[model samples]
Target: MKPSGGSAPGGLFSRLTGFPAGTGGDGVAALSKRQWTRLTAAHQVRAVVAHRWAVVVLALLGAAGAGAVTLAQTPVYSSTVQLVLTANYPAKDIDQVSRGSNYVLQRINTYATIANNSGVAKAVIDKLGLPYSGEQLMANVTVTTHAGSTAMEISVRDTSAQRASDIANAYGAEFPAFVGKLETPDYVDTAPIRVSVTTPATVPAAPVSPDPVANVALGLLAGLGCGLVLAAVRYARVRTVRDERHATEITGLSLLGAPAVDRAAPLLGADRAATPAAEAFRQIRTNARLRAAGQRLTSIAVVGSVPGDDAAAVAANLALTWARAGDTVVLIDGDFRDPSLPGLFGVPNGTGLADMLSAGTPANHALQQVQPELQLFLLAPGTPMPGSAERLLRTNELTKLMESFRRDGAFVVLLAPPLLANADTLVLLSATDAVAATTRVGFTHSDRLAAALQVLQAIRANVLGIVATRP
Candidate 1:
């Protein structure tokens, strides 16, 4: 993006829009809300779904890397000895009775302190004839209560298993002498409280780390988290509304519950499951209910910009859903060029919409009831039969047909041809209360869809909302 000098560089609308006068990020070409919705819905949303696999791969790599690193490291032996303290040292008068095993855990810290003290480290360093200082020598030592409980252990790590054992013994060997200075026994018994060694540490024959299995497990977990988070963020930021919240945000439409796909014919069920595309249409029905808001909306039309928008499928499923909901539903196949509803419901071709319009057959006579409360009507597409298609759509009889469907308590879903591909959609858009357009990922172009939306806006078509098709 070029810097804004406040003249749009070449007098574009950016200055008028108050965006910086540039031609890239702040350029006139920047996608509008409608275009952004189309672009992101057609691209980013599915990309997030694809990213799950990437996340899994990365997580596995991370785990593998961690494990390989752990395995490749040089082996070191750790020695630990559990100590049992019978009484509190340096403060025996405090109470030996209640202290019990806690005395062992509590006093062990003092013992560790004495063992790793400058004096002890110096002694060990000198005994081993080490070049390192006392502090440096003690840095390798550790003391702790196991599992946040009252059990104490003294730990030391070294490169050699034998040397590790020797260090453990050396620390204990000097511990009593050091503690003797800090506290005296009430009575010097025949046996002095001892710090006997336990589980002398040894260098293992096998490496203790670089676990491939663990790495893979952690990697998978990491990938799942990354994938889920990415999917959520993508879902949240999407401009395309699939639910009620999106209804108000995108087209100012209210949200009704998603209508169920009518499960009547074998083909309809198969079609519903064929691509699992009904959910988008179901949401459209839901938005239709919202757009109707207190007023009656008997004639609901589904439109799009191209073929393969599954406009017919949406019409069928929506009619079935409404029929199932105890409302009469008429599924109108109004795509006068590429009629596809005949095979869907086993209706004969060539004899439906074209014949009805040309013969001046009643609109109700053109309808075919597909289920108990659902009816299927064919508007067979091809060349219009003289004052047929457009005339039928824009007539008082057509209005009366719609009124009859409403009077019969039915919802009508007219499956119209895509706007860009058919003039009939624009012709019908005028008579209908609302329009719902479909956007398929990858197949639908953002800019073109935005232009179509602009056209719809100019005509003031109450665009119910958009239903994005899954890739």
Candidate 2:
């Protein structure tokens, strides 16, 4: 439906200010925080999808680095020797045996600490005849004890599996003697505590470190997380319109059409009438008509958000689409600095809009009929007058000419200059009944689109919608 005046209902400003849709009032309303969050999240997802290749490459690189490090490291083997500590005092009754078991459990932690001490490491090194010093041997030894039990485990690691096992076994065999000497008193003949080996250390069949599969998997996961963060940052910083949805969100305008990128030809021919590009133009024409259904949509200014947006081609195709539907369409090259409609229509640009406005030339004399069968006419920019183009467009003659076309029941489509590039576009926009903005996918910046819309809204110009075109 056609929006009241020019402001779109539920537009970007309306949504931000929490005002009632289409009111364009100063009153405040409830904010749509949830809707804004959903839009931001959608944009982030699209950004990540657009940079999927970069994410994949990073993950692969991380995995390769992890695999390289894993393969280059030296493999180490581990062996564990289990020991049980017990009370050596004789127990004749069940109560005394229970008391002896309690004593062993209480002293288990102390024995575990001694197992990992430098003194025990030195004894084990001497017994095994190993080259390592007490400090070096203790570095690789680990002692652990179970809760409510006298069982203890002494584990050792080395480059060689056989050496690891020998070191562990030596620690187990020498620990008992060391503990017995420490527990013995000067007045007693025997010690009150005893240490015994319950399980002998064995050579491990596999290394304990540098697992290739696990390292690569972890690296890949870490890299993927980093890539996602980078993608989100890029999305937030670049601020370019990602797609049709992004363009709509930035401009707060309805989507008229999304024509695919076609570089071979700027104008749609009869042979391509059944193609997607032709259908897209037809859709845009239909949507524009629908938006201005109840209003007098006599003149439509086709403006580009920025240069290189191909607004001229869009305007040309839209005129053709209307002309094909049996409407008298007047296509005008309103861009004075760089007139492209003349070249696109294969016509000479001897005299047109500029002469009619500045030199008092008759509008009928400057108009050229390009396609007589389709009832399509063209008006070139005539002479280059970049300096005074804005002044010429501001004259009353342009408004009168548009009214004259409207009286003749002819639809006028003017290819105005890029909004950001020249000020003449604003003049044309003010003179026209409605505007249809053009944006090139992956080329138009979100800030530029928003700025152009702000300019149109300042003048209260009726905006039909936006047409998205690919490069």
Candidate 3:
């Protein structure tokens, strides 16, 4: 089978990212700084795309904010008046008009700046009776001349359209008098340079700001960018096992099977149901049995790191699978704190493992026939005894019971307590021939799985493999 992200489409990207040859895109291997950065970025993008609802929500929120800001702002209206700055003189021939035109062109730039002078602004303000000083009026006015053109444009912006038009027209009318005074200090009938208004200032039809569509678009882009960043951060900091790939990478154990996440379904294989969950249990059973034969295993113990995991369910279903295959099988509920074998098989919980241990009763006395047609049996934990359960599990009677089951040509499966929750599972380590860990993806933290594996290895338990539940 080809490794994940190892196909031609992703080969170049995987090499640049330094992903291992036989590992998947979601590998948890420790990587170099550059590789980590690239992989982390890629993972973040994938995470965001996989969860599209986040993007929609963020975009909507951003759009709403931008729209609100645009609406809350004050609307402004602008008016512009064009003036033709021509040389004014009585020309006898074309040569005189050409020379005068050149002279006026040289002074056009000076006139553009002069139009914004404090004196010119004050004159316009007084002429229009505006409610502002020369400096305040200057803030609302602008003057410009197009390149290689003798036309000058003066503009005024205000909240009121009428006021903007009045201010613009005042500047156009007053500028000519100001220029005349500068050119000829003495009173004269005509001036060398004259300014004339070609296009008079008119009230604007609409406001120039607060464009709804543009604001919303910008906001949506900003929100989506923020959502992408958040998704990346969440993926980078995740510590739980997300899938079977993550579990195998962290534990370095063969992945036997991944049972479906179903809270409503009954114990798989109990009724010989041909469901995905049941098939998963059968696969796990086959893998475990193969490993057991090579290691000369007689009794197998199924355990987890924490309570509420599907460890007991896996053990029970595995025993049923073997029994269905015409092999004698017995499931032992070793978890005294929370025994589920009696409830799962619908047998009386009275007089079971605890009873067998108190008295030197035969192991079969407590064993209940789960399926008469098939060679399947169950040993319930009976009652809750959290205090002495660990001590009771470590007794010599447990070893004797395992040997008795093996002699009867029946394979034993112990649904042991969570390894981290109690020491009962460790007690079964010496008696059981093989151990299998059950884990729930997303719910199981990588640290918890690692710690459980460390304890099993420290005790020299023959760990067959790991079975991921609800992958």
Q: Which candidate number has the best TM-score? A: 2
Candidate 1 lDDT over 316-342, as tens digits, reads 666665665567566767766567776
The residue-by-residue lDDT of candidate 2 on 71-158, one tens digit each, is 9999999999999888898999999999989888888888887778777787888788898998999999999998888888999999
Root-mean-square deviation of Cα positions for candidate 3 versus the true structure, in angstroms: 10.6
Candidate 3 residue-wise lDDT, 299-347, digit = tens = 7899887766678678878888778888888888887767777887788
Task: Give Cα distance to truth, residue 240, candidate 3, Å.
Answer: 7.1
Candidate 3 residue spans exceeding 4 A from truth: 1-72, 83-114, 144-152, 176-199, 216-255, 269-272, 286-299, 350-363, 382-392, 395-409, 441-454, 457-468
Quality of model 3 by C-alpha lDDT? 0.76
* Segments of candidate 2 deviating more than 4 angstroms: 1-56, 89-93, 222-239, 358-364, 384-391
Candidate 1 Cα errors over 4 Å, as ranges: 1-56, 81-112, 130-133, 144-153, 177-220, 227-301, 305-308, 312-427, 432-471
C-alpha lDDT score of every prediction, in listed order? 0.56, 0.80, 0.76
Give candidate 3's error at residue 14 in angstroms: 41
Return whichever of 2 and 3 wins on lDDT.
2
> Model 3 misses residue 27 by how many Å?
21
